[model samples]
Target: MSSPQASPAASVRADVWLWAARFFKTRSLAKQAIDGGKVQLNDASCKPAKAVSVGDRLRIGRGEERLEVEVLGLSEQRGPAPQAQALYRESEASLAAREAAKAQRKLVGAMAPPMRPDKHARRELRRLKDSM
Candidate 1:
């Protein structure tokens, strides 16, 4: 019989692991991300059924955020946030990069114009376009 510590060394499906880790809300979303090449195993693209074991590296791209983590534990069941977080250890470099990206996005958003222009602004834009 295997010991409790040995369970972390066991392999689980890539999608299952992602879901269990709380990377995605559901297994289907994890599978979709894997299929779309948004997830990588060991620096290479992997399928949903790929075996994920402890110590394996994973790069997951979700929306504008990219995370690089190393598997530290394994669980097939989805649990609380703390438990899920225990599944992987994100790299310090990845955390810094994400924070920088977020700050850049915030700066850019602040500089962007409003969604809709006023009537006067629209008229001025139209006049400018007609002159071109």
Candidate 2:
């Protein structure tokens, strides 16, 4: 007989940890990301069942956003957002890169034309095409 707090899990499956950490909505999604090479452990691609423990680094790519985080704790259960967030600590460099990318995206979005062209604008475009 021993105290419950005296021992904790030494490792968990990569996919399970990702889902538990809230990086992906579901374990299957995490598995897919791992298979697709969108997730890397310690700078190397790993299988979904790869073991993840504390202090290990993880790089996860989702859409245009990439995250690099250090594992702080281990959990196999999906919990509240706050609890999930506590499972990993993102590096400062990763945070800065994400912010810079977000700013760049905003600038690009500002330069894009509106969703719909006005009647006059459409006619001008048609006139240019007909002249060509």
Best by TM-score: 2
The true-structure Cα RMSD of candidate 2 reads 4.5
Each model's RMSD to truth, in Å? 5.1, 4.5
Residue runs of model 1 more than 4 Å from their true location after superposition: 1-9, 117-132
- The local lDDT score (0 to 100) that residue 111 gets in candidate 2 is 100
Model 1: lDDT equals 0.91
Q: Write model 1 residue lDDT over 18-115, tens digit each, in one string.
A: 99899999999999999999999999989999999899999999999999999988888887798888879999999999999999999999999888
Look at candidate 1 and tell me the lDDT of residue 52: 95
Question: After aligning candidate 1 to the native by TM-score, how far in Å is the CA of 3 from where it should be?
Answer: 13
Spell out the clash pairs found in candidate 1.
none
Pairing residues by index, what is the TM-score of model 2? 0.84
lDDT of 2 at 131: 100
Whole-model Cα lDDT per candidate? Answer: 0.91, 0.91
